[model samples]
Target: MAFDATRAGADATELDVLIVGAGLSGVDAAYRLQTECPDKCYAIVEARDAIGGTWDLFRYPGIRSDSDMSTLGFPFEPWDSDVSIADGDTIRQYIQNTAAKYGIDEQIRFGHRVTDANWNSEQACWFVTCQTAAGEQLFRCRFLHVCSGYYNYEAGYTPAFANRDAFGGEIIHPQHWPENLDVAGKRVVVIGSGATAITLIPSLVKDGAQVTMLQRSPTYVVNLPRRDAIAGKLRQVLPKRVAGSVTRWKNILLSMYFYQYARRKPDSTREKILHFARQQLGDAVDADVHFSPSYKPWDQRMCIAPNGDLFRALRKGRASIVTDHIEGFEAEGVRTRSGELLEADIIVTATGLNLQLFGGAELRLDGQPVDTGKRLIYKGMMLDGVPNMAFAFGYTNASWTLKCDLTAQYVCRLLQRMDKRGEAVCIPERHEGVEADDMVDLDSGYIQRAKGFLPQQGTKAPWRVHQNYVMDLAVTRFTKLDDGTMRFQAAPSRSASPTQTATQAA
Candidate 1:
């Protein structure tokens, strides 16, 4: 169990658990592993040089968490800020600070991109291949925890439009925003009506840019204050942790109720949301054309505007929304299908994200490849038939961390139970006759685009990923480890060390 550099090449390292990614989920997983499974050896492998996955990567005009920080933050670490909706930089700092506080930063291997992970039934371990600075490196671990988010980091989703080459203006995507590009006093057209577009419009307008959010269809937009007065008052009287817990549960219940209400009463929910948008925009913007989406509520993610910033921008004539289809790109700007030319000095494509699973790493069981799309998810964490592996995927309906925190806790409990039972391999087996469903039930553009590649869910417990956080919390946090689905076994006798084989190759 000690560092096995003697067997694998001197450069190779062996661990009890290998966590991929050093983002919020990864860091949270590390903290749980260190706390709950203190005897195990673990390391966090991050593709980027720095921590904070999505928060650190996005550096557009305005980047912030759509969900409140209380629920988004780890349950162990209480977010003490008065601002419920936190900015990107603050969130990034908080993640880094958490790592530092828990001594997790040292365990992170920066620039170690996991290219492939192969499970060896003979050794009961995962031989991970990583692309590092020198070349390909190897990491051997008993368990592989994938905390990498569900998006492609290399690029955002940008569709090819006709005559794109004719556009002479500067074009950019918020995912890869140029540091030196100037947008002051310029005409900017931000395409898409999702969260990125909502955040960017206000930020660009504040920076003196005449911004226009050009969307092909309408999306639900709701306004919330920047600071939560109730949270602030609770903090004044109650302890920080207690107040945080209260606020967290409050947000959780409210979100669950709203989502349920939206689903059960779609017409009323849509009307209420549109009414709020109309109040914010006044008579300046047409609510029916710009804010009323054709789909039912919760069909796609509802955009949250802090302090009514997006509406304020529109009211002040700093920003505007245009709902139309794009005909093509012209020399100066984009031409609409309605024959109106949108003059722009810079074009921002805030389309959507390209979804990726397990950081797009190739997975193989023994020598055979494992197709995740065909596999059933076990408790929303482990895939059926995948041994000693767990993925930290959060809720689509509620705050992401709520589910992730429970997943981390559940994994820790699993590792402990495995150790106690002297189990080397634990694989979730799919029972017969279970109905298969989409990995995520959401109809978002990104989710739909990657539906064919994602893992399938089931109709019953253990296999079903109930998007409800409360149900997930009860199941993931308190469920017995020896559930009928998860099968455990001892390690197979090996002739040679797996580490040595990998090291020699390295």
Candidate 2:
């Protein structure tokens, strides 16, 4: 039931829920909302012309997930395929299929970009304004769920090259991959060593391009096959719940182990990681020029996928890694700090995305600017003073969908509680001492670069994002829905408990 955007007409449409961004988060939100509250009216407003937000946007040579499909994918819907790490196309199809199966496809309006949303304190609704291909449209909804994601819709990241304009080679960003661009038999230099750069290198190599990864620093590189043979075997006989739990634990423990190893024994961890990378790359390649990094393990992000595709590509001589800081861009190549000019016909900047709070839009409460920097994130979902609004941001280290699932479940519980109490809104208050800007703990390049643009964490419960799934389960899933902070004024009989202000309690 695909939505016929042109046929919807220009009438002011109202819904119970107005979701921004038809990406993974938004799609998941719709699914959860529809499944739990079947009678609720909801519409997904996508800025893009199609569904699949990041998957559709990123069309680089080898775009794929960093985590295993079993964990990275949605919780309710299982990826019933042989490939553990799925490509963008497959992932897109899965989302589309999920939307269709849940009867949510018709709910999405393509080319509908949200311009602004002003919370009406008196009306108790969000007045959303948007620009669509049809015309200017307005949507009024009780809940404004933002799933636009942190990354900029346009070109994500740009490297600081002294002579970017002077570079005669075709410059390209992974986000805006050219449609007519051909890299076959061309010397390709990919800058940045994040997921995109590593993923691109392996695929470009197969496409007959001599790929060289120009990375300023190194990341802890590890390999697993595309499929867990042990897990696959167990899944054949066991139920989905048991199998998923087992696989989840396996990945969780491995991730925790590596995270701990990188933190506690960085030197040994670096030696082991580099040694494995060298072994994978083989002796024919120059290990000194490529595998070494200036920083310790986990100082930057680590890239991993099943089957060692990137490393294998390097071993086959189809690709090479160059660890050097780019001094500037020359007419035909990039000049490194070591006084070496690496010639390239094509340059791909996989420098990552620019982080934005609430999808880079300034939130307004009753026509006044809501500073997210000053506010505290409540349970990684709601913001203080903002009623009936919740956002879902996945974990950086582990599978994204895992955290999203928890957030969704928590949101559902909150919604159910609100409904039971006959409450029109649910606003979690922010506590004091947690308003400081420097609470988040991740040190990724993107996080460091755009720390000011992101939201800060609270010192106490609900505000802190403990990456441990078990602990998060207790806080997000099993926690009591009736927290004293949430007010239900619409109810005839108000609770007798003393109400605490946003500053007094969390």
Candidate 3:
């Protein structure tokens, strides 16, 4: 895994499908394509030394999934673990196991950081440039699938504060959490109110740090336990598949009901959830100040785990919540707008990640550039007018794996449809009269942050992200495979002349 970054610079390699990441999405895509089209020449080029994607990168204390493992884990693989919520190490192990099970590890090229990719319209191929431990290398491929994920590979956003340079204490970003960095007994101030901040506060407090969660605004925080004992016990006694099915259904129904309630009865539902947080924390804390949010639930992201360890941590007095506007940074602490300075020996910016459009990688079709910002999403898989390329994006409301599973299945269907019709390429184009607003997804910072740079989907079927597995399965999995949205044309043979060739050489 030791990459010299100098050796790989020698030459460019040609591949039928050049995958730019080895993360869950990338690995999943490779798994699907390899199984479906075993003859296709493909390689997964990863920037890191090992696989596991996000699981490998995030190794902070108490790193675990926010959602239940049943839904979070891949569909083909059942997470047969008794525990409903899994920790970071377990998740990492699961990923490794899954990769090995599917023989995906061997195909992943570690330490392969993609620097640039330019699509050649005339050749119908992509010239990809990357840097590895060995050196820089170019890869030519007929198709490119960027599973780099939405988060910028670098650190998440950290606002410039006055006198930050003068501060001598340790500063860390969650994305770049060091293995040897110690927080034990240090006065730790975790800045941000998203899932990372919530997860880290309780974790660091257990490590003997006086943790304080600093937030600009309140987020909907629900307290749940780390394990669902009843569910675990049932799973232990009943068959794993049956138990998994039951648990999955329960979680899905509950999630759907909550989402429906939030959308239909926003005020009452918000009060109900806020009450739950207050009950968990008790009267010692200011519920109105720390838990109140201006927006409805799910309008922003909701943080949850099996049992609310964060609430327990707060109630135990190991951690405290500070909802205020940060003025700036002092030498040894954070200065608030109220003129109070909260001293911290270490500051962890657990701020949210910056969502990149198409994993921040550029896209082009033919000679003309295809700006994702200006495009529309076709069935949330392919972009309108982009030929022979498809993206894997999951559900925003439910577990990511479910939507991704559907996407993979749908891609297979699309490919099969093309093959049956003897089409060389299939492109889905949006109708002329479609309005812009219908395509816009005005939700959390994760989606809205790159609204323009992302492909737009309408509120109706195919475009709408229902998050309901049954609804999606009906549409994406079992719907008529041959849809009229896709245009088909015959593929010219390899010996075809320049004017007649349908595909460019990789």
Candidate 4:
């Protein structure tokens, strides 16, 4: 395959596929593309200086995947460790190792940040604009695959606390934890009831800091073991790959069953969760006062307490949780709405993440700016009315990798189908009367706040998004590429003359 300049930008590098980001989804996409579509030429442009998108970015004291690693990790590679809840460093290494093993690392172009992707129907390719270390670089690809994780990597969401500057202590957000930040023998107050805040508390306590977690409201929390005994047992008996697949499916099924059960029977599920939560707390904190949540179970993500480490911290008097609203910041600490001052030598605002799509890159159709929020997602991968482009958005209620894995496979399937049919473009055209709804239906703060930026879903199949892995697996894997909704087009002009085609793309 050679570069095609006639149908693409004069200086643009032509590729069969262009992947944005070298994160989990990007790595997974590369694996699928190379294995399934061996003839296609592809490249991964990562904005960051290194691999492991989220894992490399967040370096908080106790950063770890909230979900079990069996599902969080790539489906092709088996997680070697017994630790279901893996630390950030280990996970980063795992992703890097996986990429290197599969030769996906060779496809990565670090420091190339894709800022814009414009579609040209005549060329049947996307002209992608990227900001690199030297300057701007352009790429033209028939298919654009966005594997960037959903979040603004530049910064995390931090609320404006009144008189925050008046505080005499060093303030930090989990997104940018400074090096040599010693919290030993100091009072530390971590604001927010989300997973980040919950994770940092136990770690801060271990660092010899007197930790106090301040939250405006209580969030549902549950404890899962750090290691999966069943996974370990399966590994010992079955072949490694077989064991990994089994462990992955076991966790996926359990997660699906639990979420559905909780949604269907919120009252009973709530009671059961609270009962187990209370047992973990065991009088270390008052359940009604500090642990009881206002929302039903599964409405928002439940805070995972790995091995009940957080509970142990509270019981041992190393850490405490305070449910209160921040009125203002004092010279020495945070002032509550009730006028109780929470004295702290250090404050960590683990508020939440700022949700972003497509790595903050702008999309255009025929030079007209496109709003994904107004469009519907197709098969939880491609966007409705968007041709030859796919973005990976993982399962909200389950492991992020589960949906991404299927999405990559779906893209490969679509590509193979397109090649076989001699189609240049494929777009899911929504029919009339397809009512719009939020793509991600979670009531979490991050999702709710970013509703205006996120895409919408329809009330029907192929357009309606399912958070369940089992449902998505069935639909994305087995569903025909040329479903009635998808409109496939071929450029007759390109087929005839001095123009761009898959063979011309390198």
Candidate 5:
């Protein structure tokens, strides 16, 4: 049976759990809470006035899933679409439909941008403050689950060009693409060599625009088919549920094998990746010049070109790539440092995102501001010394939802354990013999820009944040909950642990 908080005349001000953000992670958190922890009351508070988080926010042309939909889609409700590399609209609709079908949408409070959350240790609850259109509003909950992704929503990172104002035509960032802007019959110069630039080149060409991607350096690129052949075959014979499970696992294993292979033997993996790019490009473009990367494979994410669409656009002379630093923007276009002038009618800055944690909401423990970066993440969900709080962050190598789903399920287990123990407060405490490291190993631009703002992961198990799904599955599902790290206190005895006040962070 579906849990409807609104229909039961429950107090919206109080809840068993409070989830922030309505994106992929938020929706997953809500569904898991409803089914697994049916007795617990919860509601979703979305910063935006919509359901889809990333898919709803990003409206750039040719925006699609970087990974296959089979692995990216929620496991319980599998993606049935034939197109494995789905477009943004399809994903947005899928999320919306899921929320409506499960009555999760009815539990949402739209336009509620969470600002601050202060723990009330006496009550073993969190008073979460939100900024809304009407003004500020506060809600209290036993557990605070933040599903907001780690990127800043209000602004994207854009380096200051020497003469940005001098550009005569329209200059745009893919983050806030203007709906009325037309790209057809225009010479568009896109800056950056990341995933956004790769996806945009092909789409811009299809809209009758000649695009040239300008980058300071090259990035590794791979092509995958637009549709899944195995998915087609499986669905033809098997039931929908069985087919989805098989296909999801198949894709997951293949991706895991490739990622591990890249990590172990980078030289072999790099050459193999180049071979595919060379075959796709032929003599149309110099693979060594445009596709070669400076860093090792998997050091940063490899850009995916669906169906070799970006390559096709380059091979047919519909688009091009320039590997050079920019002197600055000119009236006509961007000028390269090499004395080459590339003119364009429009400019698209596909630079990257600015990483933000908890949707820029400040967290506090007993009225003292908690420095999130100073704390080590326990099991990649809860932070050290943060009681009854969990966050959803996804994988860097594979599809995001795979890790997010596991995180939500683990959170549910923690809630159940608290109930079983008759405890009102539960927190993970950092112990000795554990060293801290960067939250993620990747050196991507977004990750690099957020050195001090991001949290750290431990070097040992229980505290270590591994990217492998199989290992995560073993730990989150099979491991015992009372592993000696998570501390639970009955309501009468609940107080900020004495150890928490002394050494609570990294």
Candidate 6:
């Protein structure tokens, strides 16, 4: 049931679990809570008016899933289409369908933006504050689950280029694409060589725009067919769910193998990727200058152009790639450091994302504030020293849903164990002398920029994020609940002196 704290007062409705965000992760969390912990009453508090998260938010030209839908889609729900990499609109519809099919939509409280979550040790409950359309509201819950994603939704990362304001043409960011921006028969210049730029160039070209991709440096790009034949064949003989499971595992293993191969045999893998790009472009362009990246393959994310669309556009003279630094924005277009002038009717800054954690919500334990930057992450889901909280952050090396599904299952298990043990408070204890490392081991601009804000990883098990989905599957699904690092305690009696911490061995 929905509660209006503004009209009904602060402590209006109490919930067993309170989930933040209505995206894929949030929906998955809600489904798990409803199924695994059926007795618990939970509500999803979405800041946005709609669901689908990144899929719904990104509406730029040719926006699609970088990962295959077999692994990216939910395990319970099979993607019926032959297209492995789906477009944004199709993915959005899939999410919406999933919510409706499971009746998860009814539990969502839209337009509720979580501003702060404070844990009361004495009461063993969290008082969650949100900024709603009506007014400020409060929610009380036994557990708090954050699935708000890792990037800022309001804006994309845009660098302040010199003389940007002097540009005569309209400058746009892919994050905030105008609904009716005309691009037909126009000269378009896209800034950045990442996934978004690659996806945009082909799309803009198809739309009758003569597009040019201007990049500071090259990123690894590979071409794969739009449809997966193996998945298609399996679907003919097997049930939808079975085929989906088979395809998902096959993709997961293959992705992991390729990532490992790239790490172990960087030079060969890089050569193979560049060779493939050359095959697609033929003699139209120099793959060495435009496709060869300075860094090794998988140093950052490798860009995949479905059905070689980007290469086809370049080969057909619909689009071109320029590897040069931008000196500044000229009145007509962009001026390069090499003194080359490129005129454009529109400039697109497909730069990157601005990473954010927990929707930038302030967290407090008891009466003291919690600084996530200083704390270590426990099992890649829970922050150390934070009680009754879990965040669904997915794997960087594979499809995001693969890791998030495991995380949801683990959280449900935890709740059930706590209930069985009659525990009201559970927290991960940080031991002294434990070495801390960077949260993510990526050299990408976004990850590097947000390092100070992300939670640190530890050197040992449970504290470190393996990033490998197979390894995490074992750790998250089968691991002991009462590990040595985690401490669980029952609620204190009214006449009791104070709260006490109890530690147990794994």
- The most accurate candidate by lDDT is 5
Scored by lDDT, model 3 comes in at 0.73
- Please report, in order, the local distance difference test score of every candidate based on alpha carbons: 0.88, 0.75, 0.73, 0.88, 0.89, 0.87
Clashes of 6: 0
**Better TM-score candidate (2, 6):** 6
Deviation from truth (RMSD, Å), model 2? 6.7
lDDT of 6 by residue, 371-455 (tens): 8889999999999989989998998778888888888888899888887877777899999888999988778999999988799
Task: Report each candidate's C-alpha RMSD, comma-separated, in the order given.
Answer: 3.7, 6.7, 5.0, 2.8, 6.4, 5.0
Residues 1-506 of candidate 4 have per-residue lDDT tens digits of 33344645668887889999898899999999999999888999999989999999989898999899999999889887679999999999999999999999999999999898888776778989899879999998889999999999998999899999999989998899998888889999999998998899999888899999999998888889999999999988999899888998899889988999999999998888788778877877887778788888888888899998888888777888889899999999999998899999998999999999999998998778898889998878888889999998988788888889898999999888888877888899989989998888779989999998798988988888989887888898887777889998875565421123444653
Q: What TM-score does structure 1 among the candidates reach?
A: 0.95
lDDT (Cα, tens digit) per residue for candidate 3, span 1-506: 33222332224566767776776677778788788866567788888788777788888888888787878876566677767778988988887888889988888888788876665544445667777777777776656677776667666777676788766698888888888777788999999898889888877887889998899898888766667666687687888777777777777777778777888898998899888878888976787888898888888778873477888888878899899998889897999899888899898988677776555555655435678776677776677777666666666667777767677667766656655675556667676656544343336655666666766665454455555666877888777654666675555443222222224543
- Residue-level lDDT of model 2, residues 1-506, one tens digit each, is 33222333234475777878777778888888888866577899888888888877887777888788777777777656547778888888888888888877889989888877777666566777788887878877767888887777766879677988998879888888988677789999999888888888888887888888889877666886776676787689888767766776777778878777778898998888778777877876665556666678766667874477887887777777788788999998999999988999998888888877555556788777787766677776777678878877887767777777777777777767766676767787765555444445667878888766566777767677676666787887777765655555463232211111122445
Pairs clashing in candidate 1? 9-503
Clash tally, candidates in order:
1, 4, 19, 0, 2, 0
Candidate 4: worst-modelled 10 consecutive residues by lDDT: 494-503
lDDT of 1: 0.88
Model 1 lowest lDDT segment of ten? 1-10
Return the TM-score for each candidate structure: 0.95, 0.90, 0.89, 0.96, 0.95, 0.95
Clashing pairs for model 6 are none
Off by over 4 Å in 4: 1-8, 495-506
Q: After superposition, how far is residue 12 of candidate 2 from its true place, in Å?
A: 4.3
